[model samples]
Target: MAASALISPAIHAVRSASAIVCKEVIDSHVLRIDGYSRLKHMMHGKYIRSGDFHAGGHAWRLLYYPNGSQLQFQDHIAVYLQLASRDPNDEQVLARPRFSLLDQLGNPALPHDCGMHRFSY
Candidate 1:
């Protein structure tokens, strides 16, 4: 029969709804990497990170290891895409990522498209 006890239950009764949406590209940005071997991206310190880029109102990065991710395949290259940050209120984000490796004259030697994937923080 106390005022403080009555308020405690109501404070915990909060809910939120989740929904999905899509965005279209009105324009595009092409980042040309010539002499890619000479480009060195290094994290300055333990807390520092490299290769930060922006796309679709979000921060993203591409990590590349020329010597492969593991010891087994040192001859090959390892690449990955990482989402740097996300809004807490947002539960899911739809993404369609495309990647290409070009030759010296800017022709696509290898192209990859990881069609429509869901990303959540």
Candidate 2:
């Protein structure tokens, strides 16, 4: 019967979503995403957060071609993965994926801002 009563549910939902948000940036060029991370990326749009990511000891690089000219990209790196919490009892897990970069003597610019790089798919 009152305005306060009608608006109670909306306020509750905002609070709920706020409580679940998480983010962290441990290093200058690395990020650690948590279990609650979600992100929507745009080239020149407002940053939609990616909940949590792991970027420790991780580096970025570039790719080149024979005739020269950097490998252009519309989407720098876009991937989606759903992972569960690790189990103490579960052993023999594989190592995290690796990233590499190389420098070019001439032709083709590098991506990822590395001095030089080699990228593999």
Best by TM-score: 1
**Candidate 1 deviant stretches above 4 angstroms:** 1-21, 26-49
Task: Give the lDDT of residue 57 in candidate 2.
Answer: 28
What would the per-residue lDDT of candidate 1 be over residues 1-121, giving only the tens digit for each residue?
Answer: 7556445544576699998986585322345544444432331111222466777877677666655566686555555566777878677767777777777787776878878787765
lDDT by residue for model 2 (1-121), tens: 6556355444444343336653533333223333312322212322223344334323322221122222353234332221223435443323233233333443333333222222222
Q: What TM-score, over all chains together, does every model reach?
A: 0.56, 0.17
lDDT (Cα, 0-100) at 66 in candidate 2? 21
Lowest lDDT block of 10, candidate 1: 40-49
CA lDDT scores, all candidates in order? 0.61, 0.31
What does the lDDT read for residue 18 in candidate 2?
38
Off by over 4 Å in 2: 1-72, 92-121
What's the CA RMSD of model 2 in angstroms?
19.6
